[model samples]
Target: MNVKYKLNLDVYKDRNYESIIVAQNDDKSRIIECKLYADSQPVALSSSVTAAFNATVNNVIVAENVPCIVADNAVKITLAKSMLQLAGMMQCELVLSENDTILTTQHFSVFVNKSVINTKSKYEPTGANLATKNDVNSAIETASAKMIAKDSLLNTSTSINLTSLEDTEQIANGVTISVSNNKITLSGTSTAAVNFYLKLKRAVTLEQGKAYCLSLQNFANIANSGCVFYPANSQKVISSSWLLSEVSAFKNAVATYTATTSIIIDAIKVAIATDRIVDNACNLQIEQNNKSTAYANPDLIKSSIKPELYQAPDYTMHYLYVSNDYDEDTDGFGVTKFNSILSANDSITDNNYHNRYTIIVAQGTYTNLQDRYAGLSDVGLVSYRGVMMKDYVYYESENIYNPQATIIKWDGATGFDKSTLKSEDIIKKCPFHLDLNVHTHIKGFTFDCKNIRYALHLESGGTGYATNWVVANCIFKWGGRADCVDYADKTTVPVFGCGHSFGEVGLIENCKIIPTHCTIGYQNHDNADNSSFGLHMKTGSNITIRNCDFCGTEIQARTLKGAYSDTPNTVNIEKCINISEVKKMYSAPAERCDWKVTVDGNEVE
Candidate 1:
């Protein structure tokens, strides 16, 4: 077997030459220059080249059996120290080529001479506390010096994994790190407030915009534990400035939360004592408590307790009827107490009896507004509740000479007198009002005010007016007088003036209002007198007038008085026909909101 010799060559810094070629020498022993390459790319003399290589030398036949001297002698190539500055384990090649023709080759490996700048690296100091205090300080100082050299690299990334919080000292000037049992505090003065969000911890506030990192290991100990960092002027329990005084206050509040739990227990005891929970129909089942009638009757209980006990009508249901043939003593429920217009007013207006009864008026013409039921001039049925009247009011033509006039007996002593129905009569009997005392609802009633001032007048007394009133399917015929000038005057303002005053959320639907006399001084325009409208709303809202007919009435069907310098009120009027304009009636020159009126599927602009 033929044997070929091989040798390993390493190139380092030398004084004689920066690179050398290893080969056989002739008598002259002249050196040959071999080109070097890193991964097939030509490695220049000054440039660094860190790569693996394969080198070889071949004897080129120049003229048939004559070999080239330089190609045969050039065997190995040595790279310079300047060419090994790049970081990496690399392969390099030394090629002996003449005129780009392959001659010989050799292989070798190359690596970095030292750590390179701007290169990827990782610290792996482990096993036996390889990193010391001095080592860390030296690394930091070196990094700081490098950053200072390159002024653009002011922000440097650093990572330190702390096993246990021990070396928490002044790592930098005016900077200190601390660690408690459940917290790691890094305190330092900063130029501005730093945004920090740590799990299960309140945001750390630094004095003079200092920076801090508070690590909360046990989150359960903190109240309202969250990872929310609030900025300047943000909504938070603690504001931007977290002074020492604020910190103390927060600590005190935390203790209060614990103390408040005991106080809540005491408060709950007092609440339960004051409002006793008794057995009611909602809780008790029929099988459990079958004997609960749930009625307020003291005499009935006594009768049940003793068989020999006797009791009169308890008036518990509060039913009062009106009829002509009835005695006040015996026939109490059958209309004796509520026989005439005055007597019915007394029973219905009494605070003890009002809102407690269903006043059923029999079919009759009770034209006694002044001599009987007219106790208060401006108070019709002031603060009344519950249902009133069997039939609203039936008008029967008495005389052809005065078709709008009616004749009635005055208390049977003054004989018969021709009394014209005025608007004050309606205001004196069943006035629609909104207050705490009156929750009046007049349903299925006809108000006949042919010669009266108004059919239905709304006058609110006291601070609060009446509410939740529904007047449905009612007819208001022959409303207002031809000469109700007093209504236009300020003597008795808004008294027996307008047909209906809507002061609350009232639903007036499917009603017909026909006023024969549209009264003088009732226009709602510039340089005009008082205009008596069919439906007048004075500073009211949510009044719905739908599916109603107003035939041959004076002025607008629905009008508004904004009361000047008040907020605009809203009313919905839909699907009504044969009425005048539904607009605002200006009383005085004041700031007015453009009325939101829509008539016949068209908005009034």
Candidate 2:
């Protein structure tokens, strides 16, 4: 009795969402039937489509390119003995393709239950029957006879017998020929040139405008060796060396003349090539072997036949790609090309909070000069990994290290709408706005602020809190003159700002801040007054800054008073470099915060 295991696979679902259980080494009585669906609809399989089952045991590929029987929307594959060699979990995937183009892939898992009976035996064959020695010898002899008959129709040759040559056949009078041990030798005095022609045993007809390849085997190993051919009943002597300019052809042909030397012509063959007879013979043998009983068995097919090697896919359902110079109609995400980043971000629905996405951005400059902010806002559980500059740049210099190659340039300022003191309203005008319960990551980019107030704003107002965020390997540039200090009408701002009241935690590592203008004193413009600091902190917030470089700034960081006045703000700065003449590393106007600044483990006060 046969047992069937059924599984329903959805293409849009995550990997390993469903699994199947099977017994170990039970290959004969078990089969797996799978029905594939895409977006709640059954996938239609036609005659042009093919499916393959692949599985990995302990991260090593053991079963690759095992064919599956497909009917309509269902696929069935029998268990192979090699796949069940060990009793463990297996990672499996089904690949569907049409005309060699992959349509969709569905991934799942299989658990092989351990067997109690031990059936260990030596010299056990995996096929239906083993071939005897007589059967192998008979197959070899039949293939050899077919190859010899095919060669006779394509080639013609002649043997050289010095004793039977006529006077007219000898071109040089001073040269003489003799035979010993079935070897023909030509001996002559010094200054004697040997050039002669022997009649062919079988006549060969040469057609006009037809090319032929000539070769000689078992001839004398002499320098400048070559041969010439003469057609039947024709006087035209075709020299193989002169007819072909290829050096390989010239080396294979017997030479025309050798001075003062004994030349031995043991055996020689010259042919007119039309097709490869060896390749045809091998293919014929393969066609015959494929009809054998051992090859016909489905269980023995994997060991008998070898297909092309399989390569795993790079990006799966968890990856999204972004590129500016790609067409959406022709390109697919993480397949051949990519689309826009904004489109990739918005495509994630609200119900997919459990899925974490990695947005891969290609190296390019993104600029927005509109009224509203131009970067990603309110996006949670997403990591933006951009292609960095160090991957392409060969030579390192000052300007190359300042602004990264992947840049996000925008002119959004906080002073656009100064009527509202709410943090939510002010964060909408900044480039990057992080809200409550969000874990975001930004890396490998340069935020080019065109004299903007803040490059990033972390909102922490009215039950809102941002936590567990990271900003690494980035640059924050002012994008203005280095000596300009006029700030009468403009609002003074930090590169990054955290709102007051709620608690927050974040980290900034391996970052640089390039302030193009001279530092000015802080001026309170409706309670926004941290002009000289590079990073502004709020009450009840903890931030860690490590391995950073801050230039042209009076203070590195500052903490302001918050609604919870007793809760102190904590800022830890470690292994940071101050290139400018900054007076203090950090300061708290309310004197109710904790600040620790360290350089290579030593505390700096």
Candidate 3:
């Protein structure tokens, strides 16, 4: 009564594949129409003019007529090598076109794997010309060969000294050298004349009869010269000695260092050119900002020297360690809070400095003393009720509305009653408010602002917009008003608000935020759309949430409202889990343009 069929085409490039097209037909010896299609183009069909199996030379195809023994009422079609060579997704169709009337049809999607490199040559460019096809092919081949050679050159390193070179012809252009009495002398016609660009940049050169030192300086020259050397004087070139051995060792070290440095530099260059360097890992310790100076003496670095009594302050780096072990008043070494130190005037005044100030917060809860003293008070009058009297009450009836006023009438009548009541003495507030100025970090501390607004307000304008701020391995909990970390632009709207704001490159990683005690302003805001979120990314880009614990009792753990401008704000959430009452971790409307939030790995829809 009903027909069912399935077709499967598993095509691997350059290899013959079998395609099965099976359909239901119970009648014995019934003619069934079958055809194979590659990329929607017909490529094969059942052989002969009868209800029999299909056959193709070399290309295999097996067909079963009606009254078949197989359970699927099936037929198998083999694809030829020529058909398989056409690399693309293939589809097969089976139609019963009897008397120009079709009974049933079936279609299937096939996976096609094309060859990585095609072997057959389709074109012949014989004529010689500047831009001819042959020239193009040759250019491609040469480029490929060069790429391979570069890789090999970067992996291997060799060093050479002038001990064995017969003459200056082996040396690079413009280099003046002399070998005499088992020593090699290096000089130049002009300071910049020598073609030792790599080694000369570091100023690593050989001095007559001086013990050679192996270092990065020598590596550059070896890499530049490819370890080729020349001896200018025959009598002085010792050919083999301890000094010559030192020269060789130094040259070898230089070669290794130079090649490795070049490879790293090339990698960084490629990353920067593609504008995707963010995804790449860069080793800042190796080389920084292209600034290098030659060592005055390598031996001094090796020698043990006494520690200086008075070490000059390194303006390039600043460290403020805040711990409860030391008091803010008595001991000068330690401070209690992070924000207090930031509020102080800028002491280190060096414009030439690239400063990295790290504020290590000790493991303890910090409260802003200002928030407790200057917090909102809770002494107010309660509601009042009216009293029934025998006569009319003397009260302003037309326009007066006082819920707390006690009303009195003409004949012992009372209008309203008022009473003073106090429940919460003082709402808790955040101890210290931070308007981030420098590249600061707040780590390993618990911000206990039970009834306060924000623990750290990263608002633009106290000094400037906060950039490169990180909150890692810290606990921000029990805030009364808003998020522990809040962002707002001071240019347009001076004060920071919880609902909407803007930020740039904020990282919240390996931190904990407990939203249970936070006053997130969702009480009267019954509408889910207008409710507050724990980590509200109203406006920002490159805000990453990695390996953080987010716990909240609100509608959602976070929300992405995007930014004011059309430029997309991106927030990447990786290796983060929602350990809260809310099931839906993130909530974002689809209509918002240029706002993207990726969770785990995929973008949240």
Candidate 4:
């Protein structure tokens, strides 16, 4: 009789039957029919839907990616003889998909019974003998014993005391030996080479071809001395000779040598040449272990196999606070009060400069602004002027989207004459000078430039290239005349400027640039008179301006007087809004300049 099995599969739950018995080598006689359901309703399959059946035996796939017949919610999988070749429990699953997207997967189990009537089948048992528990246990015990014996032979150690010099004899006539405080001192007026023999209290045997370590404690003034190990009865050297200076020394000196033949060491021969004031040697020890050898100790084996559980250490974030209301006496690290941002920046010295610092500025207008140099890593300048300190620290991006409450007011344009200024002086006039190789984050601070040339300037710190500079969620307000007759006038200053260097990459995102006027003069067509810039780009510099609103300024691209000729300047403007009437968003040299301006995924001509 043909064997048929019926089962129900839920879309969300896995089902396991008591046992779906199918005889070995049975293919055509076995058929599995499954009805799919989602909750209490039957699942309806469309024409585009397909089903696949997979069966695994002992983690090996017997039937993989086999297509099954699906009608409405029912699935039929006809077993193949290859799947039922070995009789054992099988894990099966049905996957329903549409257009290569899996809808649901249902897992189930099946059992294939061994058949007595299929004796002639190719999958029949060959009646080979299998290993018993006793055989496996005996094999494991033999392996453990062999490993233990090998480890013991390599790690065996022995110590020898050389405290007494009663039997210490010298082969040369110019040498003398004495012992004090367990140290043997060789003192003499020897101009030629001298040999000293120290007899061992008991003989110690070292195997042939085995590595051994000889360590001498409290050894000094033996720079040109050599040592040779001799056998008990014969004077033949058993180990290779080694110089005392060639070995490693701390408080003690250690040397390694391989025995040429199996010999029992009964004496150590030291040959010292040249005149010496005093040469001292103390407690000596030997071991079979090499200098680079590693073997687990028996006492530490159990602990090594199962180590203690690991737990992460507790972390505490330390922040530097800047507020005008705080007392000046409370200005230091590990405290919450600082008088000004300059003091906070100065407090970070070389001792604790590597620590990550988040200088939080409290709600107040700061006018005592100077050039602050940050030549460290992971520095963040966060302003919580109008927002709560906790809210600005936790939800920074959300709060910075609003109006900035902290204002750093400075008339940076009063005495800044760019035409006659040197390159280093231009960088020194700015408020913040950051290292180009490190990352610095500035957010939620309104820089009110009272006719200043630039609201913020980025310096390269002598690297000649800028990288990892992020200025976000701030306002650059220039309160100066935008139009002037002299093209070198400070009124035509840009909000952001760079040092005398090119940039690798920089970011200015989610900021507002508010200039006093949009156009430099009535000559809007002339590039010089119309140079009201937001960010000044250097030749071969790469800067990205994203999601910023420009009220009355344009991004100016200009080549430095002596910039590299090969590299091109690139400025990427993504999703930025220009609220001014300036048709051209950027200006560059008409010729001899390879510059690229991209606006919202398209290149601007």
Off by over 4 Å in 3: 1-315, 325-356, 362-438, 461-466, 479-503, 518-540, 552-566, 579-594
Off by over 4 Å in 4: 1-318, 329-336, 351-354, 370-399, 412-428, 461-466, 481-490, 499-503, 517-540, 561-567, 579-591
The per-residue C-alpha lDDT of model 3 at residue 405 equals 18
- Cα lDDT of candidate 4 equals 0.47
Ranking by TM-score: 2, 4, 1, 3
Candidate 2: segments with Cα more than 4 A from true spot: 1-317, 333-340, 350-353, 368-403, 412-428, 462-466, 480-491, 500-503, 518-540, 554-559, 562-568, 579-591, 594-605
By TM-score, the best candidate is 2
Local accuracy of candidate 4 as per-residue lDDT tens digits, 135-246: 2222222211121223222332322121122234353656676543224556566667666666443235567887766655434443524332222222444544543331
RMSD of candidate 3 to the truth, in angstroms, is 32.5
TM-score of decoy 1: 0.32
TM per prediction = 0.32, 0.40, 0.31, 0.36
- The model with the greater TM-score, 2 or 4, is 2
Give the per-residue lDDT of model 1 (tens digit) for 1-605. 01111322222114232222222122211122344444444443321222122311110000111122232222333332233333332233333344444333332322222242212222111101112223333322221111111123222121111111111222333333333321334444433322332111111112232222111121212222112222211223233332112122223211111111111010000001112221110000000001122111100111111213422222111334454544646324333235553355444443332123334344445455424433333325453321132212211111111212222221111122224323343333332222322344444445554323335543332111233444555555543443333333222221123323233345556666655554321122111112233233344334556777766332322333333212333445678766654545433343443234456557554
Model 2 per-residue lDDT at 221? 26
Comparison by TM-score, 3 against 4, better one: 4
- Winner of 1 and 4 under lDDT: 4
